[model samples]
Target: MRDLFEDTATAFALKTDSELERAYFLFKLIGNEPLVRIGTAVTNFAIKANLPVERLIRATVFDHFCGGTNEEECLVVADRMFEKGVYTILDYSVEGQQVENQLDYTFEKTLKTLDFVKEKDAIPFAVFKPTGFGRFKLYQKITEGEQLTFLEEEEWQRVVNRFDKVCKKAHDLDVSLLIDAEESYMQDAADKLVEMMMRKYNKKKAIVFNTLQTYRWDRLDYLKKLHEDAKREHFHIGMKVVRGAYMEKENDRAEEHGYPSPICPSKKATDENFNQVVTYMLDNLDLMSLFAGTHNENSSYLLMEQMQAKSIAKNDPRVWFGQLYGMSDHISYNLSDRGYNVAKYLPFGPVKDVMPYLIRRAEENTSVAGQTSRELTLLKKERKRRRI
Candidate 1:
């Protein structure tokens, strides 16, 4: 059972030789910390200077990482992945929105995606970042319990409206909606808002899913409290558990603000916390639905092991395994091949607008120990097998 994920032929079966080489090259480039840093700096400058880098970007990293510049363009990728038994979560990865119009644009885009996926099983979920729907400082203020001015209150209501619109649409259409977890300081407001949505729409099942960054030491407590509320209120709980993406930013902010870091002490501790939380969720599967968002083989194995131990079905509707589209085909394809519910986060946006997300992916690949190396190792194995 453990060896199932090692089947590279099944993993990369859809990748042509050239695409396989491109992936190997991208991972190889991402493995170098210094190179990634310089590349990010250069790319940011080019975008800021209004340089014609979109075509070049669209030809390289953008093509590899994102589906396309819009929802319609994402269908090709979504359909292809669905053909192989993996589902897609269409992610509008545009960043740094500062105006209400842009927020509405994201809201409308999310609504449009929900409409597109309403009748299509290929796309099971639609996702959006909270900061995309509203300003970061707005969430920070609410999270900090600061007083809101009258106009600020109106602005907050608009944000709430955006959340409600999407969650309600998702519920009405029976499509699951995933609200992403952001920085620790702002996540409190998002979590509360998501819990409210869950209470509203999850009476029948988990239609609104909140993300839990398991790297936070207190996430287990949060999950327990959520479970308690669900038990009392008769609402289903849906949570996507990820190791986390903002460790450095979180630690730095804690140091700057003179607060104890919310992050776990070390990777081992975080992994343990992740495992423990998943165990808790599986143990209480009756009222909670889990979206295990990870690329770690051991964590994937642990979930499979627990499912078997609990006599759960592989295609269980209450459980899912998720990975980013371009990063973890091995896990995504192999899991779906074995009949597990799986979804890939297929980020899509214009090249210039999506650079921030693309850059972060590069930086994350560089910073996360062993992730890039593992990709390289697998890509190399597949490449050698094809004598490429």
Candidate 2:
């Protein structure tokens, strides 16, 4: 295996001590159980102090992982990543709200996000969750297998119109858009929507990408099936593979509902399935474009090995590597250094609004073994280098 420090050292060689300290602070904070448990309390206090939470967010997690709160704000970070030979994927992380005004606001934010990135060559993709700007109850209805009444169906058509506008804007300006994968219960609706959009927009080139969660055993096969469907439908298939984020919830619901859990039996099983899907997608590069989104060292290197084994170019246009903006610099920067297409999944939104995303990251580190420790080690080494 390659030395972990080598890629990181080269990538952040210009970072100052203050930057290193900040990175370390987030690393340790996210890893600490006690600190993260009291996060709401901390956020509440920060809000009460009338602190510029957005600025604090910008300086810390946002600075590390996302582009900005909006498209215009993203340019600074996007340009910087461009300088490092990395690309940016703009994610408008506005979710879990219920207000017509908020929902309309989300649609506007999404449109603005698309308009901003269309001109940037380095930003090859844009992503958003339908839940970000839509009703969760409606999504829940769709998830529970509820048939929409005619008016509800009309509202669904409006949702389609919204997508048409977004995809059309992206298509007119020549940018690819990705629909994120959500909870398993709701994923069917998301998948169907993306497939419909892909059929509508991915004729000449893939303008719509669907996220596939391989942690669910069904999705590896689903990738092949999606490709088959793409073939029959006569449009390109764009897919992003993640190990999945909602394992506990999926399992809990499975038990609560008396259904088989969809998660792979173990982490190894998930990794194996994920790598297999990567290989399958890469082998058929003519028909599909893929994003290998993971922070796992083995999974990332496995793709590199597969590319070499398959004689694909080191920087194949059909494949790219991705990790969340703040949490996986080691993976993102290293892949960029090695002449691979690498992009950080940079999410942007107001601090209070984006707390769910932030909290999930913190919880993920604590739950996933060695994630926080690996990050902390890198931050400390970089800090030590700065001190010297």
Candidate 3:
């Protein structure tokens, strides 16, 4: 069988020799766990000490991972991706925001991106974290089923209002909106709010998407229940299936709280559950839309094969393959070249604000088994092909 993702030349065709070399070095650096830890700590210290490290960071990791610092800057990357037959999901990657004003700013920024994408075919979806629009503590409180004070009740209403406005805008513009999942503590409120939005905006088609992290042992069951609910209620289900981030945090929290861990006991189990959910969603394509948001080559190939067996169209609007903007160009570009619907989660924000996201990416690449090694191997293949 011809491997769909074997075209390293097409994957790296847009990269200059210097860019390719930089990526090679970056992945190599990330693959070294000790170096990554030391570098991350040093970078944090430098930033806190007000040292001049932003330029170096931007020139390397930031430039590779993020679209740019703002929407206007993101257009350059979006245009390039569109030219290559891949779509963009403009994600405002700012994190750890707590103030009401900050949350309001994040909400307006998301609406702005939604409006921006309405005029641009290059950008297919808009995404925002639930934490971006409300305080994490508020979500945790709601998840715990705690009673809210008068002021907290007012605050909760504000969060709901923000969600409604964003979902309504996406509905009006006919653009898909992805609500990102957070940690387990904060995810219940996010799931409830996202479901409410789905019920309202997904009446005719999937205008709202809720992310499902399949690494959790219960998520597959949750998906089954959500599917049943969608069928009974006569609405569409839009989901971005991922193997979940926050495994360490989720497990740590569970242990601290004297609860059994919600995460899968083994990576093999997580992979199985992830693929099973993918199969279930594809089997019910009429009632659901799916975005297979993964960097795993085997999972991507499985989805392709399943689509073939089911005779799904390559450009089906209800199905998409997604990866982070810079981490998996091999999957994104090669899949796009093969006429599959593909999108990159192009995150953008001011450098400082998006550092947490960048650090997480770096850590994830380092910690996820074989992720950095795979990237490095592909880069080397491409470089060798180019004889650079």
Candidate 4:
């Protein structure tokens, strides 16, 4: 086990003892409950004021989880990751801005991001959210299988056009675009849109990737269906699977309505489904490219074990790993050390506009069983090691 972990640690060449210590300390600070609560309060307050919370955010979540405040600023961090033999996936974190002009601005920013990626070869993926380009009500209609108003129907077309532009830009630039998954109710539209774009643009290479939230029971089955669909379409599938981000709200909404919850009934079920999906993807590595977006040590190690079982190479381009920037240094560094292709989801946006993202990170860290404790424990261990 030690040797395996050590081997995985080889990919992170940029982290010195000092940098690791800094990461440990940052995680430890964020894991503190009182600190998280205070940080959340201040950031939300700042959001209501429309003031830039960069300083407050930089001292809190962003300092741990993001690449930088903007694209230009992120290059230094991306360079560090490249120096360590890892890649960067730039994610634009602005969400819930609904005006049509705002959507145009968002689409332009996405194009600019793709242009930046073309100019910088180290960035492997450009990440965007569908909600960034479409109105929430329109997405709700699509997910509900309901008819849209005349205005909404037009807006929906515009949404599709925005995706066409983004996907075309990515295809032209020869970079991958990852369509991020949102809440379950809205996710169907995202999945369908990505499937459509992939069929159109992923003729010879994987230009569009869809994210699967394994915390939802339906997603594992959806993954199977996606694979079948891709086979029928005769195009490669790019998959990014995560445990999911909307647990509390998902369950609350399910209980509010009379519908059964889409999320797995228990943590055990979620873990089981996640592992099953990972194994299935590993078995079909020839036609699928996967990014396992998780921080669980067991899951990471098991992925490696499954790859070895199939006699797949450690650095197989079909398989990559990721943890959010600042959240799982150990996982990222260790996996990089093992000669695997690993990247960080490096979000960059104005702090006020990004508060929702920051708040969710706080909530997720709090809810994942023993996550805060684990982070605190690791920090203490590193501190003790330094003292010794």
Candidate 5:
């Protein structure tokens, strides 16, 4: 069979010649580890020094990767993707805010995104990190079983209230919400809260989705356990599965804390476990909804093949494919063209506030074997085809 991933024309159709060249240049830059390290250091220094670097960053990586700096600005990008049969999931990408006011601002921003998606069928989901709504220390404390003082107890209650408010809004609007997975230390708290939301709002359908990072060795068993609970409680389970980010941080923290790593021992192990979970979810499709959030071509193809074998409808509401915006256009567009439900995780925020997200993207592309090279090859092919 011909490879759907090789369709450069469909993948790059939204790109102009200059955008294609910029993408090519950016991937080439990321492929060099030393250059990326130096560049990241210099960029951080420039930002801290209050230098005028936003324009330079905006003209290059920011434009290629992010939707815009705010919700209204993202509509154009969402419309463009909708025209191509792909949907959007507007994600507010700000991070590391700790003050109460900042946390409240993050919660309000998320509500705004949810409100924006309420009437926009092209935007199927809204997502936020749990840490965005509360202090990371609070989650870690709760996870570690640290007793909270009177003040701390009140703060934790506020965190719960914020989550309930957002999830209630999502349920009322009939818009799905995705709660992102964070690091292991704080993840148990997040998972518990997300499960609570799932039980409350997902009783009828998967209005609230919890993300599962399959790179963790324990996630498969966790999924099985969650499924059992869902069946007993009579609520549908909604999940987005990815191979996982934060692998280096997870391993480093494990070593520092003198704990066995939660991650899979090898890449092959992670891949096999991801596929196994995908198969398991498909087998129980009647009780769950799944979104395969991956950039890996093989994983995408595997999900498609399984769907076909199970005779699932091409646009099944319970099965969807997702990739981050500005990456894996080949998979997103091709799958949508082939009538699969597909969406891009379109992140938006002020440039400075979103730098952490951008930095992680750069690091991910640099570290993932063959990722940048593949992107470079596809951009080059398209540029050559257009004779640009």
Candidate 6:
């Protein structure tokens, strides 16, 4: 049971010898923490200086991690992965812009992606960050319960309009929309907006899915309360449960601002929190749908066990397992091979605009205990099997 993800043949079936070696090389580089830090700094400087690093980047980490520079290019990659029975989520992962035009562009992109998801059986979900649809400060202010000036109030209305437009389009098109969670400070506002969308769009089923970052100690309680509200209001709930990505930044901001950290105190606690949330959602599957977003093998096994115990079918539409596009082939491919619903988040954008996302991937691989090693180990096993 524990060795299900240990099958290198199924895991690396899509990777050629060259692609396998590239993955090995990238994981090796990412395993060195100091090298990753230095590389991140250098990459940021080069991108800002307008140096000719795009070609280099595109040929390496960009090609390995992202689907492509745009949706058209990404479709080629998405189609290839779909051949292996793995589904994709076309994530518009560009970062670091906060203007009205950029916000509107992201909103339009979400609408466009929802149309794509509607047409393609390979793609199951459309996703976007809250800040991608509006300015971060505006969400932060609302989260803090600050009064909005007249103009600010109007701007906030545009943000709400963007959320409504995308959610409505998804519902009309019969596509599931995933709203990603961001920093804890601004998440409250996003939560309220997502709840409104869920109430409006999830009447039939979960067309609008809100992300629950279970690394936060308070999230399980939050979900329980939200469940109460949804029960009273007669609306179905959809949630994507993830261990979270912003741990270091979250702890640092909490310390600097002299507030208690919102994060669970330890990795074990966070993992337990994640499992508990999954269990709660599974226990209440009649009223909720779950997208379990994880790379951890233990959690995956736990979900598998729970499903079997509950006598749930492997192809149940109400539950899904998700991983990032490039980072967890073993889990993604093996699960898909076994007929479970699985999707990979395939991020795509211009090189410069997407550098922040790529850099964060490298840093996360570097910081997370044993993640890079696990990737390296599997890639090495596949290479040896291929005699490469």
C-alpha displacement of 156 in model 4, angstroms?
A: 0.4
| lDDT comparing candidate 4 with the true structure | 0.80
Tell me, by lDDT, which candidate is best: 6
Q: Over 4 Å off in model 1, which ranges?
A: none
TM-score: the better of candidates 2 and 3: 3
Model 1, residue pairs in steric clash: none
Write one digit per residue (lDDT tens) for candidate 4, span 1-388: 4344333234234556776666666666566778878877876777787776567557755756777779998999998888776788888887889899988988888999998888886788888898888877788789899988898888899999999999998998888888888888877777788889998888886778888889899877787887898788888888888888888899999999979998899988988888999999988876688889998878888888888889989888778898887666667777776688888888988766676887877777866777767666655566565567
lDDT of 3 by residue, 1-388 (tens): 2476778988987889999999999998999899989998999888888899889988999999999999999999999989999999999999999999999999999999999999999998999999999999999999999999999999999999999999999999999998889898879988999999999999999999999999999998898899899989999999999999999999999999999998999999999999999999999988899999999999999999999999999999999999998888989999999899999999899887788999999999988998998899899999898886
Clashes of each: 0, 2, 0, 9, 0, 0
**TM-score of each model, paired residue for residue:** 0.99, 0.93, 0.98, 0.92, 0.99, 0.99
Model 1, 262-342: lDDT tens digits are 999999999999999999999998999999999999999999999999999999999999999898888999998999999
Two-way lDDT contest, 4 vs 5, winner: 5
After superposition, the stretches of candidate 2 with alpha carbons farther than 4 Å from their true spots are 44-62
CA-only RMSD, every prediction: 0.9, 2.3, 1.0, 2.5, 1.0, 0.8
Reference-based lDDT, residue 384, model 2: 70
Clashing pairs in 6: none
lDDT of 1 at 105: 91
Q: At residue 304, give the lDDT of candidate 6.
A: 97
* Model 2 lDDT per residue over 168-194, tens place: 887887787877888888777767878
Tens-place lDDT per residue, model 6, 1-388, is: 7899999999989998889999999999999999999999999999999999999999999999999999999999899889989999999998766999999898888888988888899998999999999999999999999999999999999999999999999898889999999999999999999999999999879899999999999999999998998899889899999999999999999999999999999999999999999999999988899999999999999999999999999999999999998898999999999999999999999988999999999999998999999999999889988885
How many clashes (backbone atoms < 3 Å, residues ≥3 apart in a chain or on different chains) does model 1 have?
0
- Screening candidate 3 with a backbone cut-off below 3 angstroms (N, C-alpha, C), the clashing residue pairs are none
Cα-based lDDT at residue 220, candidate 4? 71
